[model samples]
Target: MDPKTLLQNFINGLSLGSLYALIAIGYTMVYGILRLINFAHGDIFMMAVYFALFFVTLAQLPWYLAAILAVACAALLGFTVDRIAYKPIRNAPRISALITAIGVSFFLESLAVVVFSGIPRSFRTIFPQSLNEMIIIGGEMEVKYGREVIVGGIRFPVISLITLIVAAIALVFLWWFIFKTKVGMAMRAVSLDIQTTSLMGVNVDRVIGMTFALGSALAGIGGILWAIRYPQVWPYMGFIPGMKAFVAAVFGGIGSVPGAVLGGLILGITEVMMVGIMPGAAGYRDAFAFFILIIVLSIKPSGLLGRPEIVKV
Candidate 1:
């Protein structure tokens, strides 16, 4: 392949990977705290995209403002979901919680369909027209202007830059919150042993709610980013990304923040490379992710970053 095409593909992969990482963080966070899958996460992501679109088109809001509103709405939805569906079953059997997650997932999907109708909606393009501008790189190659030149003329997308900046800020803030603050300690305590933490006077419920809110907020940001990159929206849009993000969470070690990011990048790069190397398999691009999920499960059931559970005799 030509250098230009190869460079462009790499930039695309990174942008795609960043979205996966954002969504995967949500999965990892929830799993870390509650050990529940929260199958509704993807649907929540879809809702955020729709919410942004609705605000922009119906409410006549600016795109940036709409995006913020969507993120806030998604956070509220996630919080409400926890309170209404999962809170009552907080002390139930593990199977009960799992079933509730599935039920909540289906309910949210149904609600989306009913409210938005089954038809897919295309979102307004958010990329600038100048996004396609190009600059001469090597004597034989040209690099797109949207791609940043950090050191040589090697090109990368502006979106990739934004993704990296936001992700880094989020990680820094998350690390601080989890390791430096009193509330962070309480959260860690609750995750280690909820009953013990409760006995120690920690508000387990509030911490869990905060965890969900944090995860959902990440998903909301990811949803908006996905819309910007793909320029399409639908009620079912979150299903694939959500599932893939879950796979990424498992691949990286479900409870590990850094693991989730690593897994997402791996998945994103693998899928992109698959397309690049096997042009004939372009139609199955989506299946590549699931195939990786299966292989990871078969080879390392505990996941790349997941800690194996200890059972008492």
Candidate 2:
């Protein structure tokens, strides 16, 4: 492959991987503390895109404000899902929580179809042209669909570049919140020992709720960027990406943050590189991620960065 095409493919991979990483972090965070995979997480990502679309088209709000509100709404939805769905099952068998998570995911998808209809919504028809300027390329181009950027004389879609930038900012802030804040400390404590942390005077439920909200916010940002890059919103849109992100979380080490990021990047880059190098096999792109996961798990069941679970006798 030529350097230009290879570089473009690499950027595409990074952009795609960043989206997975953002969503994967949410999965890992919930799993880290509760040891339950919140299967509804991808639906939360879907709702975020619809929320942004609604705010921008119906409310006629500016894209930036709409994005902020959409993220906030997504966070609230995540918190509510935890309280109403997962909280009641906290002490139940882990299987019950897992079943409930799947149920919640289905409910959200059905609700989206009922409300938003089965048709795909296009940003070009509904949103102002400013969405591309502010959200995609930032005044670099005026095209309605996709725009390219020339860096060192190689042209690549600006959406890929900007998506990476946005994901980086969001992830960096998340790292700071997780590592440097009081709530973060409480979160870590709870993750280690929920019962002990509760006994130590921390609000266990509150901390868990905050964790959900924070993780959902990342998904919202990722979802919005995803809609812009792909330029469509539909009920099932988040399903594959969400599943891919989950695979990324497991690949990186289910409960580790840095590992999620690494896994997502690797997944995205490899997926895109495959399509770029062998165009005929592009149809199998989605399956490639799981194939890689199978290989990784064969080598290290605990994942690339995950620690083995210890059982207390």
Candidate 3:
């Protein structure tokens, strides 16, 4: 492939991977602390897009303001989900929590369909026209120049480049929060030993709730970016991406934040490359993610960065 095409493909992969990583971080965070899958995470993502769409179109709010509100609301929704769905199952068997997660996921999806209708909302109405314009080179390949960075003849979309930069910043902040801050220390303590941490004066419940909030906020940001890139939002939009993010989490290492990022980037790049190289298999793009997941699981069940579970006698 030519350098330009290859570069474009790489950028495409990076953008997709960044979104996956953002959502996957949420999965890994909650699972790390609570040992729950929180299947509704994807639905939370879906809701975020709808929330932004509503505020932007119906409320006539600026995109930046709507995005902030959407993210805040998503965080609150996540906190509530934990309290209503997962909290009650804290002492129950893990299976019960897993089942409840699935139920919650369905409830969110249904609620979205009922409220937002089944129509896919167009993002162009809200997104600035300048950002929507494309730069087509010789009618061969079309790409958005909304956010372009041309460095020594390698061009990248501003959106994809910003997505990568933003994902990296978020990851750094999350790492600092996990390792440096008081709440982060509490979170780590709880993840290591909830019972003991509670005994040590940490409010285990609060820490877990914060984990949900943080994770959901990332999902919300991811949802906004996804809507921008795809230029549409639908009730069922989160399903495939959410599943792929989960695969990324598992691929990178379920309980490790960095692992989630790594997995997402890898998954995103591979998917783009696969479709690029084999246009005939474009329909099977989603399958490639799952195939990677299966291969990763078969080769290293603990994930690329995850530590194996230790059982006590």
lDDT of 1 by residue, 1-313 (tens): 7777677677667667778988998888777778888999999999998898899889988767888889899898988999999999998887999999899888888988899998988887444456555544556555556435433556565666666676667668878988999887887787688889899888888988888887898899889888876778877889999999988888888888888988998888778877987899999988888898899878987678777771111
Off by over 4 Å in 2: 124-146, 310-313
Q: Over the stretch 1-313, how does candidate 2's per-residue lDDT look in tens digits? A: 9988998889999999999999999999998899989999999999999999989888988877898999999999999999999889889998999999999999999999999997998953233454343223354555344366655566677678778999999999998998999999999898889999999999999999999999999999989988988888899998998999999998999888898999999999999999999999999999998898788778887778887881111
Candidate 2: 10-residue stretch with minimal lDDT: 130-139
lDDT of 3: 0.87
The residue pairs found clashing in candidate 1 are 147-156, 253-305, 253-306
Clashes of each: 3, 0, 1
Rank candidates, lDDT, best first: 2, 3, 1
TM, every model: 0.88, 0.92, 0.92
For residues 1-313, write the lDDT of model 3, one tens digit per residue. 7878888998889889999999999999888887888899999999998889889888989877998899999999999999998888899988899999999999999998899888987874345656655544444554544546555567677688768877888888888998999999998899889999999999999999999999999999998888888888888899999999999999999988889999999999999988888889999999889998899988998798997881111
**How do all the candidates rank in terms of TM-score, highest first?**
2, 3, 1
